[model samples]
Target: MHRTYSMRQSRAPTASQIENPPPPPSSTKGGRLFGRSNFGHAFRKGTAGAFGPDLAKKLSQLVKMEKNVMRSMELVGRERMEVAQQLSLWGEGCDEDVSDVTDKLGVLIYEIGELEDQFVDRYDQYRVTIKSIRNIEASVQPSRDRKQKITDQIAQLKYKEPNSPRIVVLEQELVRAEAESLVAEAQLSNITREKLKAAFTYQFDALREHCEKTAIIAGYGKHLLELVDDTPVTPGESRPAYDGYEASKAIIQDCEDALTNWVSGHAQVSSKLSTRARTLSQRRKNNASKRGEGVDLAGQDQPMKGDRDSWVAATEHGEIYQHGQDEDEEEEEEEAEGEHEETNGESGGGLSLMQRIGLQSKE
Candidate 1:
């Protein structure tokens, strides 16, 4: 009655139709060729009987095992990377320690060599002063002998003729001879034999002290070399089998001990040498001043200002009496600077390459 063409509802869909519906229409050529629904239906149809429930369950277990193996492999790879990074850092630290030890040993060797050089220089100065004193004595000996002969002749003449013109002329000649002798004596006095002797003694002592110190330093250096040489080289490796850090530390301690002993033993000797050197220098200055007075007297007669200026410059230079204090100060300053740099390097921690890379990636 409702136009009641509920036209008997079309017969219910058949079982096959209900289970496998027709594909939907597509708008494009590619879509028609391989539509999403068609692909899913085809896949399901193709695989429908390929595996039974039991086979699928076994396949799932195999897949899970494979995934677990992959995860384990990834975990092992990460551990290996961490170990490699640790080894790299340790190797770098060992290299840095070796370099530091080597540099310090080299500096010690250089210092020992410098001390030897100073000893030689001081020895040479001592020898020169000794020779100068000998030359002064030799020159004065002839003047003394001539003066003695003149005195003898005058005494003989006085005995022969008390008022003779020859006697008078001989007396005048004796006066001139005496004046020459006095001048020679004065020149000899200016050389200051006692001061030269003192200088020589100090230099000899200093040379001995330096020799002992050098022996100590050289022994320490040789020990260090031996230790370094004893390090074992492994096949296919550029570095030694052993890092030698502990050995280096022991050697450093030994060196410090040796240095302490040397300083203690030589401190007084050094002070004595310094004091003797200063005294000798003062004596030389006084002698030079007196010689300058004589030079002034000579200038009154010869008007030679150039010679006087040269003598003054020579005294002022005092090359013969110069000490190694300046050099020692420079060496101490250099050591201080090196220590400061080492401290700074130690205090300033650095990041590894991987860590830096990670930070950069994060940024």
Candidate 2:
């Protein structure tokens, strides 16, 4: 069989036949088989082949999607960073506000201590005034009792004797005692009013200052609260800060009112005292002027009385000189008149005392 195969062996296949013949395209049931399409093969041979374009397009779309996702992530990260920065800034602001509030609270505590001191001072002043009034009242009682006892003693002494020096002394003592007692009673009443006035003045001043400081503290606290609650960005928005500010302003206004009232009252008191002091000064000046005038009048009267006495002495001396001269002249003339008197005796005997006086006057 091998010899016969050799004998019947066909000529060696050509180079083309040696290779296997190209397989036929497989047939599909209702259409051409899905092998490599001529159009697809031709397209693949060019730069824009169908499968190549589709693959490149898919790759391009995936790259674009990845870039979009990355961009979105980057934007989200930036937004988160901004939010975090805002939160950090807000947190710092909050810390500052808390610190400020703490400081304000400390100041408020100090102010409260000052207010307590003012209250204590006012209470002490009241106590002092009360003590002063009590002392004055006690002093007045003794003075009044002494004056009454002296008056009764004087009346009893009067009944005992009329011309006794004891009665006179007793009356004088009663008068002096009564005058002193009346003065003491009046002064006691005045002291009470003065004590009340002084106490009122002190309390008013202290309370006024206390209220002012309280207002300042309240204002500071309110401002601190406003800072605490303030919004960073929205200036126009209504917030707790605005309400706190308003409340602070109201407190300040109240303080102003209290201060105003206190100042006004103080001014009135000062004015009144000034008026009284001026009146007292004028009265003292008037009294001094009257005393000076009285002294000058007394001095002028003394000089006039001395001058009148001197004039009367001079007139008496002149009359004494005239009388001595007349006596001397009569003695000298006596020798010469002796002879005439012997002849005139007869005529003079008829002349009465009135006629002799008339004759002497003629001579």
Model 1 segments beyond 4 Å from truth? Answer: 1-102, 124-164, 171-196, 229-241, 246-250, 253-257, 260-363
Model 2 lDDT-worst window of ten: 1-10
- Go through the candidates in order and give the C-alpha RMSD of each one to the true structure: 43.1, 67.1
lDDT of each: 0.42, 0.39
TM-score, every prediction? 0.34, 0.32
Compare the candidates by TM-score and give the number of the best one: 1
Over the stretch 1-363, how does candidate 1's per-residue lDDT look in tens digits? Answer: 010001111223323224433222111111121222344234333433233222123322332233233223333433433443343333334454444345336435434433443344444444334433433343344456667787888788778876667867777877887786776565555544564676568566655666666677667767666644445768885753446545655665566455444532443333445888999999999999887653423322222134211112223223321221122233235444443433231111122212222221221
Return model 2's CA RMSD, one decimal. 67.1
lDDT of 2 by residue, 34-138 (tens): 122344223223322122122123322332233233223323433433443343333334444443333334333333443443344443444344434443443
- In model 2, what are the clashing residue pairs, if there are any? none
